[model samples]
Target chain A: MSEFQPKIVAFVCNWCTYAGADLTGTSRIKYSPNVRIVRFPCTGRIDYMLLTKAFASGADGIIVSGCHPNDCHYTSGNFYARRRWIVFKKLCDFMGIDTRRIVFSWVSAAEGSKWADIVNTTNEEIIKLGPYDSYHKLSTQDILE
Target chain B: MEEIKKIARELLAENKVQVVLGFEKGTANKVRPAFFTKAEDIDKLIYNEACIHNIALYLKKDTCQHAKGVAITATPNVVRSILQLSAENQITEEKIHIIGITHEGKCAGILDFKAAEEFSKTQPKGLKPEDKALIEKIQAMSLEERFDYWVEAFSPCIKCYACRASCPMCYCGKCNVETNNPQWIPVASHKYGNVEWHMMRAMHLAGRCINCGECNRSCPVDIPLNILSYMLSDFVLDEFDSEAGLNSVFTSALSAYTVVDKENFIK
Candidate 1:
């Protein structure tokens, strides 16, 4: 049997990681094609539940990237996102969810190479972890459908 | 106990309280939510070990409008829940009266915030082992897996709203799900609608739920509604080290913030 290829969902800020990804494309930097990016106005707008939805949709890994701290377009959106992620991360840890499956990163619009590196590194980590069959097992029947 | 019944009867007879929202025996010796509006109905009020419903949730309903104030049996969790409800403006602090019972079956008096906080301190921590287990099970799932798990858990919901009706915190006259202008959730009973409704309800209760476990117990489909509330409650507790119902002066978790609050992932 062939090994499963993990699906990764990258939720990137429109002003930052999204532009960085565009830069990655413009520069023709080669990286694993595992991630499907979803652009949000800011990381603050990304409800933690969206991460859950991605996993429910069978994504093996999630990357939430936005501007660096104190660099939010909305002055403090990233600050709020950071606080929420702390609690969400603690919750994931307490529940024993594989922490590697979820990554929190800061990628500016100018950081195209950084975006490629993140994708490649996260893809390699998740691929080594194997296909997220445990996710399929955990997702409810209705959500899986 | 007979003493509780006697006091309830006197309160009704003398009109000291307009109503006593206590427990009456169900058809087969079970306990159900009861309203003791008249002296005669006082005899029907029972305070046994099986009395579990919070009854505080009913304080804001139209059915309670006629009453001058409410008097109800209180478990420790009920005290916390009532305080949280009062803090949230679901019910005014003065409109309801409390009749607390000790673990040894002795009745106590109405508690103000000061009294409740003091009383709460005397009572040991309320988080039970089962609460931790339920939370751990939820926390263990990946984000998508958690969503799928909740969708399945809420699949059996028949839109009874027994959970909302039973929750002390769910007293919005125009609930987001019930409103039509900007309907946040559909009013159907399908798995998707039910899951969305429950998820929204849990999120709304985020920091306000006192974990009375009444919603789950009241659900006809036996969905573990407490697990949903506990998931958010655990987050509120661990991150903020804050307890709901402890202070009426402050805002809830999502509503209030600190300048130094964590925001490591925002852009």
Candidate 2:
């Protein structure tokens, strides 16, 4: 059959990665078409549950990007987001979730090319990882008899 | 045991506290939570190692909330919970009295919040040996194996919510599971719903669970829910150097942050 194309969900903050992706489009920087972006007010606004929801909804990969440290528009939102992701990432790892499929990054609005690079590289990695079939089987199924 | 009863009697006799939350003999020699309001009723009060239940959860109940003054027989776990709750502003120091029981099951007498904080810190915080073994086993599995492991582990859940009810930290009036507007969590106890409920529960309690193991004790299916929270708390401590139930001024690591937090994983 044809090559596998993973469905990647990108959760980006309005002030940074979303704008960065917009810049990528404006600058005509071509990246993988595999990613779908979801914008939030701030990195702090991107509830960690959304990440799980993405996975449970058959997303093969996820990108959570926000402002760099000291660069958040709301001052400390990214900082708080950073602390949360550290523990959240650890818990996901401990729970046997394929944390490798989830990418956490900082993409300032100026980093248009950087956002494209992130999308492309993450797409390649997830292509190698293949579909998140195991997770899909577990969460989407109704129940065991 | 008499020391606790005597203290309870004195507190009741002097009208110091409206109720003393402790344990009493139950049917089949089991110890159950018993609240004493009368001085003479203090005769039923008891304290033993079997009293591992985190009685701190009672503070939020109507019995304690409506009372002018309250005292609780606090094991190490209960003391930590009391401190954590106070730090979260769920309750105040002046309203609740802590009858401290150390890790050794000895009554340390009534302690103020300051002493309770110290008592919590000094108590042993290691995971039970069996729990440690299971954690290690889960950690050793490949990612797929771990996912399957949890699926199987949660398969027997009946959605009884005993874990949330027994946990002192899960004090939300209407849990997210109850919100059907968007249906954040599935209401059914099926495999998928069970996993989602537990993941939601774990994240909510990430920086808050005090390693009390009451959730496990309360689970009818005996799912290893406690180990999940324990692992999360251990990581929170190792990475953030903050712990729950250690201080009354409770800002969990997740709720606050340093600009310099480790983020090597962020690409």
Candidate 3:
């Protein structure tokens, strides 16, 4: 049998991290192929509920990437996202969600290499964290109609 | 008790408020929320330790909303709810009157928005020392233990929504769990489904839950979900230095941010 392959989901902002990943492709910077990318207009648009939903949808790990502070195309989107992250991380930790499997980062449009590094390191870390069946099982569990 | 009754009577007699929201004798010595439209009905208006229910939730109901003015028996928790509601633009100060009741069961008389702020600051927050110790005990556990603990804690939820209904802050016309389009959460009350429901509730109530514990009180299964909100409220204060219920102008930490907001977690 083959080794376990973790299913990773990368929720990225259109302006920064998406462009940065694009630059990674153009620059021939290679990273793990385990991740599936979902794009949003800004980090502020990414709801914390989506993070929980990702776990339920069979994702072993998640990467939430956005523009760096003072660099958001929309001025205050990243700022709001940052404040939200503080509370979200605490609640996730308290609720027993393996926050270690979720990665948050600042990847600018110019930081393609940094994006690649984030993906590679997060891939290695998630592989070690193994499957998220604890949360994933909730979705697949039989729901009475 | 007579002081509150007299106050309610005066408010009704002077046409200061169309409805006086207080408590009346329920079955078997229990107290139930009672609305007094007539000045004479103030005789039945009662306030005591048994009147622990957060009656502030009625301020949003049709009876209170349609009234020309509302005078509510505001506990510290209810006052916090009212201030938080006003901050969210759910209620206006001019339409509602707060008859402040101290946590000790003494009436502080009628208070406006300004006086309510002082009353809230002086009152004890709802977190008990035992609950604080429980929070500490849970925080010390391993990540997997914490998860299993919550899963076990929320396993018995019937999703009766007593928690949401009792919560004055949970005034949304349609809760996310009820959204069937994407079906953000399941409506069923299965074990893990209840866990997901609680996680969503905790996150949504993060900075705004004034630690009222009404949700825990209203839960038929006795799920201690209120502790989760109390923990998040402390974290919100420590991280953002912002809290709810004190000021009408201040936004919750979740809804607002400064350029210098801390982000040591994000790489």
Each candidate's B-chain TM-score, in sequence, is 0.88, 0.98, 0.97
- Each candidate's clash count: 12, 2, 0
| Pairs that clash in candidate 2 | B87-B248, B87-B250
Model 2 regions more than 4 Å off: A142-145
Docking class of 2: medium
Where in model 1 is the C-alpha error above 4 Å?
Answer: A1-6, A15-33, A90-99, A109-112, A137-145, B1-18, B65-68, B129-165, B170-206, B219-235, B259-267
Using Cα atoms, each model's DockQ against the true complex is 0.15, 0.78, 0.75
Angstrom error of the Cα, residue B255, model 3: value is 1.1
lDDT of 2: 0.90
lDDT at B215, model 3:
95
Ranked candidates (TM-score, high to low):
3, 2, 1
Enumerate residue pairs that collide in model 3. none
Model 1's DockQ score: 0.15
Residue B258 deviation, candidate 3, in Å? 1.1
lDDT tens readout by residue for model 2, B1-267: 788888888988888899999999999989999888999998888888788889899899999999888989998889999998998898988878888988898989999999988888898986999999999999999987898899889989999999999999989889898999888888878888888889888988988999989999899998999999999998888888988988998799889998778868999
TM-score of each: 0.73, 0.97, 0.97
Q: State the C-alpha lDDT per candidate.
A: 0.75, 0.90, 0.89
lDDT of 1 by residue, B50-132 (tens): 88678777777666666776777777777777777767766665767677776555777666666876775576555568878
Model 3 ranges with Cα > 4 A deviation: A142-145
